[model samples]
Target: MLNTALFMQQIREHPIVATISIAAGTILASEVIWKAVKFFHSQLSGKRPLRVHEVLSFNELGDICAAQHLRKSMPGSPELTKSPEPIVLQCRNMYCSLRNVGKIVEQIDRAVYSLDVAIYTFSSLILADAFKRALQRGVSVRIISDREMVFSSGSQINVLACLGVPVRMPITSKMMHNKYCVIDGVERVEEIRRLKQRKWIRPYCSVVVSGSVNWTRQGFGGNWENCILSEDKELARMFQADFTRMWKAFEKSENNLKQE
Candidate 1:
């Protein structure tokens, strides 16, 4: 190893080299000190930087958890994973649903290409107006409703049919209790699976799902229900596939009935 004094002597012999050497030494010392201090601080200070694990409104966490559960026990196609964080926000309360509907309508209004809705009931006047506006904007709107319970959705369906919204009745002897709405042609799909059909009124105590939401006016003022809204594209894509399958199947059944 070169002696420090000898090294200094050699640098001094070349003043330009001396200056560069000193500057480099100073920068090196600063970096070493900075790193040392950082290490010491990390060891001494209990204040570690806030680690961002994931952001999940209670509803979003529910989506992530539900996806994981479905990935485990359910006999469905596996979902794509783009992010571990699968949620953005949760809309709760009777007013929350109403409040959220406005946002949903806003999103629907901005829809450019296509709008598709598969609803158990489609009687919300506010939602119907949004659909009409979308239709006016030249959006291709295709709605599939339960053939059995068109009572609640009767007015909305007639309005849509009058307004030229293509509505199809899913051919099923069972009630189409699945309230799944896909805007922009299933850009996002929410899977609402039945947990239990409860007798007592409970705000989503029985069933849960990851989706846009059910159209039931049950929230803070009404009964209770729970569902998660996800912006996760990967998960939505999978559900969209399922929707396409069911849509085609129902359409075929309807077509066969027509032929009969």
Candidate 2:
């Protein structure tokens, strides 16, 4: 009532503070209105408001269904009566630590046909041994990595290469920063056809592992990272296609080097 113009001038001078204050007021008003609506609805319906635990459980179920729908709706997705369960790992909660690394190793160990990996960094010895064991089991394993990172100290790329794993790196100076692995199932085209003919569903499917976490100790233990292991055949097919394209590109680069 005393100095409206002065107050307005001050607000104009500090636009950010004014904006924050307005936003806070809006949020507070919205919360008040929402609570009022809920209260009135509860009174009319004679139903109590949901407890925190009940709300959380409902949200958890929703999340599971959402995850399933996301993978199921993709093109060429497998026909399934139930949702496919995926393993999620987060370093912030210790879900992506060394203990959980066994989960990835377990998938690798189970690979019967092929294993394809594309990663920015490769230095995890545990992962390296898992690949070795897969190779010993007669599984075809191929790796694609960043060209520069391969020469980095403590990198297991060269070691795996020496051990007979087919490794490819782009010749470009720019980093090839992708972290994914595709684990192919044992079912071949003929096997799938045979099962279809016999009216038997295929039990095994390819798996795709991807996320922000690199194949390194720091990525698994130190950094805030997340990884997802999905048993979606279509998703695995997509990753496998990308890996194939890169593998061919790297091979072309090698040919050019030979001519040069």
Leading candidate by TM-score: 2
lDDT of 2 by residue, 54-151 (tens): 00011112223334444655767663333443323212223325435756886787776678889999899989999889889777777888877877
The C-alpha stretches of model 1 lying farther than 4 A from their native spots are 1-97, 153-155, 185-213, 216-221, 252-260
Give per-residue lDDT, candidate 2, residue 4. 86
For each candidate, what TM-score against the reference?
A: 0.49, 0.56
Clashes of each: 9, 0
- Per-residue lDDT for 9-122 in model 1, tens only? 787789898888889999999999999999889845534442211211223222323334345434443332433421211223323434445455555666555566677666
Clashes of 2: 0
Ten residues in sequence with the least summed lDDT for candidate 2 = 51-60
Error of 1 at 153 (Å): 6.5
lDDT of each: 0.52, 0.68
Model 2 residue 177 CA deviation (Å) reads 0.3
Could you tell me the C-alpha RMSD of candidate 2 in Å? 21.5
